[model samples]
Target: MPQKATAKFIVIEGLEGAGKSSAIALVRDFIEKHTGKAPVCTREPGGTPLAEKIRDLVKVADASDPLCDESECLLLYAARAQLVARVIKPALAEGSWVLGDRHNLSSLAYQGGGRGLMPLVSAVSAATLGDFKPDLTLYLDIEPSLGLTRAANRGELDRIEQQELAFFERTRATYLSLAQQDDSIAVIDASQSMAEVHKDILAVLQTKDW
Candidate 1:
């Protein structure tokens, strides 16, 4: 009998300015420090070249074109498909932990709940062949107002961030709902200081013994 191979795929998810990028970097550092191997760090909407182009269109494009929510949802999945095929799948098969800034859950929250593209979510999930599901997802929880403020301070708003406050409220609520429903997802309170948030994430990873 052969010993089973273990590969952990962790994702950091939250609304805009939830510090997902920083959290992912921290997790990568933690993994390297402990395991002597640097996990593969990447992000959705822009991992591979093609996907990145799509991401730019989705985020930076002017709003004059009148893009439908369903179309937006499909584009997300399209980018995801390319990313999985080109980057994530390969990294995971090589026994590297693939840390993603945002994964499928983001689509479920932003597109499905926030944009009211419920049917598109299921359609895209099925279309992607279900090849991507995070082994563990860390949802950085924060109040919408706080998150929005942080985002505004950062710089110009992207297409998604430009959405109304109510939109983000729905997005945040959806994230919380997912965390409650999924045992694999751990919600970390992100409203605390950066040091505290980092400590909370480290604690979660340690408890998981990953």
Candidate 2:
């Protein structure tokens, strides 16, 4: 499993409307500016055709055949497996750093914490990913209410985003808890002004050897 000498997998994680898109863009530019190498960007439950299909299934609401919690979790993993094997792994092996919009942390927060399926999520993750994980994870922390408001302003709510506020609260709590335990995970206050948030992100990246 030897990888490219300078390849690094960096993932941006957060709740809905936590400004992950902008954060990813910032990280991408930062990496290119600092390292002089463009990163291969990806998104969880996507990054490939098959994975993109799975993403749609996971995001869209179905009335007659509603997606169960277990099904949702498994579907996400299925998509992840596809992306990791077909895209992320190959890119990394080819000397390309990967900048991701979201990764396994999303499932840990959304399914494990929100759906109260931590045990299942942990087991599935251990089985699927083995020791593979992002070298650096930038977690943007935002209040659920505030995040949801932003999401609504953006457009129609997806099935997942349509979840109750309590669900997002649980998800946020889990995100913070995990960040506390993992030094590789950097927590950023997404509630700040965009400029302030970008400044904090830059400060974090500066500390890295990149």
Please give the CA lDDT of all the candidate structures.
0.85, 0.92
lDDT of 2 by residue, 1-210 (tens): 233367899999999989999998899998887667788999887989999999999999999999999999999999998899999999889888999989999999999999999999999999999989999999999999999999999999999999999999999999999999999999999999999999999999889875
Q: Which numbered prediction scores highest in lDDT against the true structure? A: 2
TM-score between model 2 and native: 0.97
Q: Which stretches of candidate 1 lie over 4 Å from their true place?
A: 1-5
Stretches of candidate 2 off by over 4 Å are 1-4
Candidate 1 local accuracy as lDDT?
A: 0.85
What is the overall TM-score of model 1 with all chains considered together? 0.94
Error of 1 at 186 (Å): 0.4
What are the per-residue Cα lDDT tens digits for candidate 1 across 24-80? 889988777766678888788889989999998888756578667877888899999
lDDT (C-alpha) at residue 138 in model 1? 94
Top model by TM-score, which number? 2
